[model samples]
Target chain A: MTDAYSSSRLVAGVRTGQQRSIARMISRIELGAPGVDLELAELYGSAGRAHVVGVTGAPGSGKSSLVSALAASLRRDGKLVGILAVDPSSPFSGGALLGDRIRMSDHSGDGGVYIRSMATRGALGGLARATTDAITVLDAAGMELVLVETVGVGQAEVDIVRTAHTTLVVSIPGTGDEIQTIKAGVLEIADIHVVNKADRDGANRIIRDLTGMLRLGPPTPPGEWRAPVLGTVATEGRGIDALAAALHEHYAFLAAGDGLEQRERAMASARVSAIAQNLVAERLTDSGLGDRAAQILDEVYHRTLDPFSAATALVRVTT
Target chain B: MTDAYSSSRLVAGVRTGQQRSIARMISRIELGAPGVDLELAELYGSAGRAHVVGVTGAPGSGKSSLVSALAASLRRDGKLVGILAVDPSSPFSGGALLGDRIRMSDHSGDGGVYIRSMATRGALGGLARATTDAITVLDAAGMELVLVETVGVGQAEVDIVRTAHTTLVVSIPGTGDEIQTIKAGVLEIADIHVVNKADRDGANRIIRDLTGMLRLGPPTPPGEWRAPVLGTVATEGRGIDALAAALHEHYAFLAAGDGLEQRERAMASARVSAIAQNLVAERLTDSGLGDRAAQILDEVYHRTLDPFSAATALVRVTT
Candidate 1:
């Protein structure tokens, strides 16, 4: 496969909803292959049609099962669904395990449902960019609904979840003070909160606690949508319909006012800024200023030059 | 207390190990005050003398108790200790809770121990910069040992932990499958791993799991230090002495060859790059190019401009 030939064919196949092409494009983006930029430019027009939904929670929150159930529900509504599971886990365990595959097996042979798992490779910021690009690819491939799942570990993961049009934060019962950690950063980003494993003990208390926390915050504006907490036993397919309905409700809310447009604008600004920063860093390295930067870093490390001054100098030289 | 006078006085007092001055300086850094660059430049020389240690773990892992225990043990050896706890939790809580303060009350009014907690107040990346600056301030204040503690949530938190000379990753027993989450990213960064709450069941299993995982990788070089997995019951101060000894041994290992220098150089490079990126972002915003950037973002959002091209253009203009 020649580079030019494959690139053009991949773009065409992706536009027509070919699974192999979509996977290939995502792989290229993940690997940071040459000329992927041009391919992305060609496909950019086809994106912005799919609704990107981000699902996030701690490990063992049963988010995988919840996501699979949600996807099945969306498929029942005749929507073409694409799922991107962002695994920040180590490379030793490549992709999803057998259990995850079995959980998502219902959609395996369905042409309308596509699933891909992405591992955290390279820098953390790069992972975010890759995930965003993957979402774009899915969106461009004519999927009406796209699901992005990630574990909430730190700020970076939370930021990734924030990029979605609607974010579902999943949690389980009996987590104890673990909810406190979620309240700190993750809760604020959620458009819909899910208490998965609702059959487990303390589920109602978890919901009540979340509601109380929500109440303690400043009141929502009259027209703005408030995040609704839902319960689900994902394995039993309980509450999946209500969860899907809530997702649609939030999406409608975003589309009603300038909310959706505003979010898109903010996301675009962030994306551009991230890309520009990476480019600046790469430019500095590629332009032979890396050695100079290293020298200044040494000076800063040895206390001969202050970091602020060293940074200023490096920026001047690189720019 | 004019600006110039206070800045100079703050530097002088910090150099002399004054607690009030250190607090004020950290406050200025966290708030992104105008004159902090000058203050930092003056204090840079006094740094590079303290051995910086970072403690990180998931919330509810007893990291606070572990840190406190380690600090007390270090103090027993006649070393002054400074502690900076980076709380990614929200601002409504306002620093450490009374419970946390009570936990460390044994060191209260002790001049040799200084503890300050930092909350995430402003931008995400800003927290990392402020944390690094706070470390510098503490180092300049004649502290022989400094502990930088943070909750492991996402990549940003992990990056902050990596800045330390020795990073201790704390975990509790029976965290089943949660350790799998840890293996993805955090395990690779640990200089020493502590399974706190050693009296609990499954502590040995967790240790065996970690050791087995470590053995699956290639053999460590002869001179390089292998990350040690230790068990601790931090609340009871069990294994505190051994933990402290391991820390000292790691410090010696770092100081033996060019290991310490190499780490310092890498940290310095990262610091400079971060500051430079921030400066570029600030400069772009301050010079009226922010509006232009936003306009480009708007175009990208509307799909009139591709993000890649927009980013390239923005980089060209800013650089």
Candidate 2:
């Protein structure tokens, strides 16, 4: 197939939400393949429709299960949903690991639900860049909602999760690190707090802790959204309805105010800045300045030039 | 109080290992304060002497205590040691949070020991840059050994920890997420695996698990160093000697071959690249391109242009 003809076909397939086309495009994006940017730019014109919701928490927080349940609930509401399971920690686990695929079995054979997994592509902003790109593909693919799920509250994960219009932070009882999580600044970004596995011991304590913290948290201004703490038994499908309702209410709240537009603008600014930085970094590391970078880095290694000065020199030459 | 005069005094104090000057310089570096670069450049000349060791693990793994124990052991060896405890998660926890200060009470008034804590500065690469800079300050301050401690095995933590010449990955008994840590690529970077709180049940199990996993891990050629899993009750200082021995042995092994030079070169490349990226990000966000970035970002928000294209435009203008 000619390059032009193949690209056009892939674009058409993505427009019609063909799974194969979506997967292929995402693979190319994840690999940082050439010509993908042109295709992504085409898809970007069709995006801005999907309500992106991010789910993140510590490992063993049942994030995957809660996401599955949430997908099932959203599917019940007759909404087209796309699930992006991102594992920034694991390079070995690629798109749709076995566990994630098994979870997708719950919605197997359903046209409304599309599930995919993404792992680390490169160091430093690579995963986030690819994630935003993949979300665009899914958004353009006509999914009404895109759920981005990640398993840790690290800085990288937080940055990824913040791309969502509404973010759900999943927690569970008996983790014994609840206070640390709150202290880690995860509370600030959580549009809704979920205490999963509510049947387990200390579930009420977790709920109570979250409630008390939120109450004591900075007072919500009048007519502004206050994050709610909800309990869930994701495995058994209990409380999934309430969670889904909260998700909708949050989205509605954002829509009712300038919150959605503000979020869009902020996300745009961040994404653009990240892409620009990545472009510059790639130029310095892999392109025209590759040799220069190696020489400058050697100077830094030998202590002949400080890293900051070396970087300044590298940037000067590149710019 | 002139800038030049004060800068020289600070440099001199750092060279002589003055605690106040070291603390002030690190604070300035952490805040990305102006003119800290010149001073850091001077100090960078004196670095590459300290045997930097990094200790990292999941929260509640007794990382802090183990670090404290290791510091004590190193100090007892008549070596000047600097401890930098980094918490990337908490924005509220600034330098020297209460718990960490108390942990340092163990070495209170010990002129040979200096400890500092660092928190998030800004999003994306901020902590890592600040960290590398602070390590320079510590390394140049006549410390024979510098231990960089961070909680969690997230990408951010992993990045910071990898800057060390010898990296110690801490684990504990019964975290129930041990396998996940290995799966997250922590095992690959670990030169020595220390299971803290070894008095707890399942310590043997974790040690066994780590050993078996290591054996099954990629083949280790003859004379290549294999990561050792050791047990330690950090609070009681039990097995501290063994841990210290492992650390020293690893250092000797690195010093014996091209490993030290290779690691240094790799770290230098990473640091310089990160610094260059941060510099570009700052310029785009704060300097000449600030207005242009805003305008381009607005276009992205309106979906008139894709983020990738907007980024390309921004970089084009900046360059």
Candidate 3:
């Protein structure tokens, strides 16, 4: 069975919407198994096409319901959608237990849609990389819309969701963290804010807090690109329309090419630099430049060398 | 200058109420420079000494002020205190730009106390290993008490504070995330539940929510071992003494040999694993076995081989 899952077959199957093939393809990419790159490269071209919406917030914020409703809305508009629900690995198993997948299980029978879960098994930065590749794979699979739902953000949330076309930073009332969330780097990247469960007490306060803080940030064109903080009760399926409308409004704003160019620019810079770091580091290690590498590593340990220096030297080894 | 920072010097300076040397010594250890380890080992004999207290909660729950007041209370009791504030680094700059540091900056001139801020840089895992090492340095520096305040009970908070003799999870009136916090892995580790800013509107409601949730969790004895939920207005210095007293009471309970042994065991296990991983990774990168790594990297990227396979192949080469 595993042999049947050679890189070529996996890629072919994944392209045709075969679950097993997509799963196998993800494993190959994760493991960096052979032929996955060819599949990924083919995927790369077909990507840059999906309306990738990223959903992230403090947990219990009803992000999954929001994604579900948004997908349903897009489906109503006659577009196929793909959902990637990212879950944290149980430290013991290092695999997504898919506990959160239960929230979106209602869409399992939707033929026009796909949902996949990925885990970070202490891969550090690898989770974000896998997510980007998976989005590409889904794009190549011909999905017109993609929604990414993160289990929760820890220190790595910014790195993971920075790829989305329009990223929503969801927040719940009562977290008393309106300022802290902004400080945590979530506020800077959010194109929309979903004050989820806004029917609850203090919901309006959260919105007001976000507005006040957003004003203090680097000059984002006021009103031209105001992140409409919408109130939503995802569990009861109320206010999802407003959320969807807010998203589309954001989409149209990005379609102006300027907005998208900036998003594309950010993602491109991240991708190029990340791959370069890993690849160059590997090459330097291969060329028996042990002493040179060790010195840099020691300096990094000593705070005398930043990661950029080590990464740059690794890249410069060829030059 | 770094040489004037060992135990004797710090203790001597500390006797004269010199705060700068104490801060510098902790920073030196937190950076984990090459020579810091031996100094740490020399100082280790004096550690296992402090009734280390851990303060953690949501980002805006005012953990810093709570810690500051707690430290102040301890200082009033003539106890030498050390405070370690763990703030998230700005990815833009690799420094701990602690916005909350202002809450505790008033103590900068106090000689019977020390405060140092640590940031999470590129280190993998939750707490930076350097932060862990710095705590050990402070413990050895003859401080009678140490308050280790981490931003939140994200993975890093749990990892860093789990070894504390007493761990307080600070929460505000409304973080509606009481359940989510448990799910995210903070509840299970909290030694005390502190509902800070009791003057806030939702204080009692959160307490009710927390109390109910605590009932649903595995029942622990209502003795000193069970975590108690307390409330305070840390900014106004209300309930600080009570909180400090609770901390000392918890510390005394844990100071009995059982808690001491458990803490030591965890520390030893952490040290061994950390050292083992570092050494093995180094050995693998050295020994001119670099190309096996390169070949493996190439294979992973080509999607012909998975990362696990490459890692295994590289490990075999090390052998």
Candidate 4:
């Protein structure tokens, strides 16, 4: 079949919420296969309907289990849910996804929930871009809600969380060194805080500390939302209902004001910049600019021209 | 003075190893002041002499203390040193640099050692590129050894360490779960492993664990170097000499083969790509393309155009 015909059929399948087509489309997007951008463009108009929520924490914070519990709860609510587990540090192991899949097998045969894992096989920027695309795929596939779970609290993970409408920062008791956690800047981004493993010792203290820290933060403007700290034993499914209710409430809060539109615009701008960067870099290696790029790179390697200057010259050449 | 004349004077000062001039140049580089590219282009020919080493670890791993000890040892051996302490998570509480400075005051009056702390106030990619520029400034200023210290084990930190000729991964006892540490991908990048605070209990076991992990890694070619795990009581000045020796030996191993040249070429390509991306983004904002770019972004915002498709159109227009 022609590429156009195949891509159109895939797009139609995604619109009808076909699972096989969704998975195949995501694979193509991640690989940057030819003509995928056209497919994405056709599907893009159908997005902006799914609520994207990001869950992030350090390892051992029970992020996976919490995400699983949340997904189960959402499923019970009659909402079609999609989960994307992003592991940026799993360059070697590649096993995090498998373990998560096994844990999420309870929803295997159900069409109401879809689970997928994304690992970093190349640049962090590329992984993030691919993630944005994959979310679009799931969103186009009629998923009412998409959950993004990142394994570490580094800058890359933080960037991923910024894509979500509501972000949850998960913490557990007795991780050692309170100072490091504070310094990580997690407090600034969370729309909600989940103290997982509440059955463990020190859970109450952590909850109180987070509440105090939120109080100490800058005062919220009138009509703005304030993040709430809650405790949960995710394994036992305790507090899952409250967490699910909070998500709905937060979505309503955003929809009540201009916050939703503002966030969508911001996310759109970020996406444009990332894609523009990739295009510019690829253009340099294209047929017309390839020889000049090589020459410029050689000069940079030999120190005859600095990198910034070479970049300036290359941009000028393109224009 | 005219910009050209003043920039020339600054370059001359840097070549003569004037600390004040070096500081000013690095500030200009970091802030990306106007005309800094020309200055760097002129100074680039004088670099490629400094031996760049990277030290990275998790927070509370005593990386700063170990770095200070290593710097003092390098000074004792009559080497001019420059240290860049990179903190990618310090979005708020810029206090990390202040605390680090207080601890590093021992070298305050020493003309042979220079220390600086870099925090993330913008994109992680921008910080990494600025770091590469700062390293070049120090190299042009006649520093014989430059050390880069990072406080996290994320992908961003890993990318920063890849710029170094030799990378040392620091570890400490009682940092909690061994599985999390191992999953961080720190083991694959180490040229040497240091178990800081060796006087503490379980230091030996940590060292043994690192050594065993290294042994289980891929076998080295006959002439290739194998990383060694050592214990260090950094606060007491114990084992600093051995760590310094390992660094020198690793550099020599690289210099003995094509490793040094290969690494330099790879670094050059990365710098070029980063600079090129920045230039392309900037060009899209220039007079000719700015209005068109805004229109395209608006279309993307309204879901009339996908970001990838918009980017492709922008690149085509630029060419």
Give the worst 10-residue stretch by lDDT in candidate 2 chain B.
Answer: B284-293
lDDT of 2 by residue, B137-219 (tens): 98899998899998667778888998999999888888765766777778778999988888889999999989998999778
lDDT digits (tens) for residues A32-87 of candidate 2? 77788889888998899999999988778888889999999999899999999988
lDDT of each: 0.79, 0.84, 0.64, 0.81
**Winner by TM-score between candidate 3 and candidate 1:** 1
- Stretches off by above 4 angstroms in model 1 are A88-99, A171-174, A198-216, A281-291, A316-319, B58-60, B89-94, B97-99, B171-178, B198-215, B280-291, B316-319
Reference-based lDDT, residue A299, model 2 = 82
lDDT of 1 by residue, B76-143 (tens): 99999999888654432335643467655879878999998877665546777888889999999999
Model 2 residue A5 lDDT?
83
Top model number, TM-score: 2
* Model 4 / residue B160 / CA error / Å: 0.6
Clashing pairs in 4: none
Task: Please give, for residues A1-319, the per-residue lDDT of candidate 4 as tens digits.
Answer: 2378898999999889999989888878767788888888889999989999999876678888888889899989899999999877665454556368665686788888888887665554776788899999999999999999998777788888888899999888877533455677877889988989999898899899988988887888899999988899998999988999999999999999998888888788778777777765565543435666778877887888888777766654123
Per-residue error for A291 in candidate 3, Å, reads: 32
TM-score of each: 0.89, 0.90, 0.61, 0.87
TM-score on 0 to 1 scale for chain A of candidate 1: 0.91
Q: Which stretches of candidate 3 lie above 4 Å from their native place?
A: A1-81, A87-109, A116-147, A151-154, A159-319, B1-18, B29-42, B89-101, B174-185, B199-205, B221-224, B271-289, B316-319
What would the per-residue lDDT of candidate 3 be over residues A131-197, giving only the tens digit for each residue? 7788878876778878888866555565667778888988888865454565566666688888888
The DockQ for candidate 3, computed on C-alphas, is 0.06
lDDT of 4 by residue, B14-38 (tens): 8888988988887787677888888
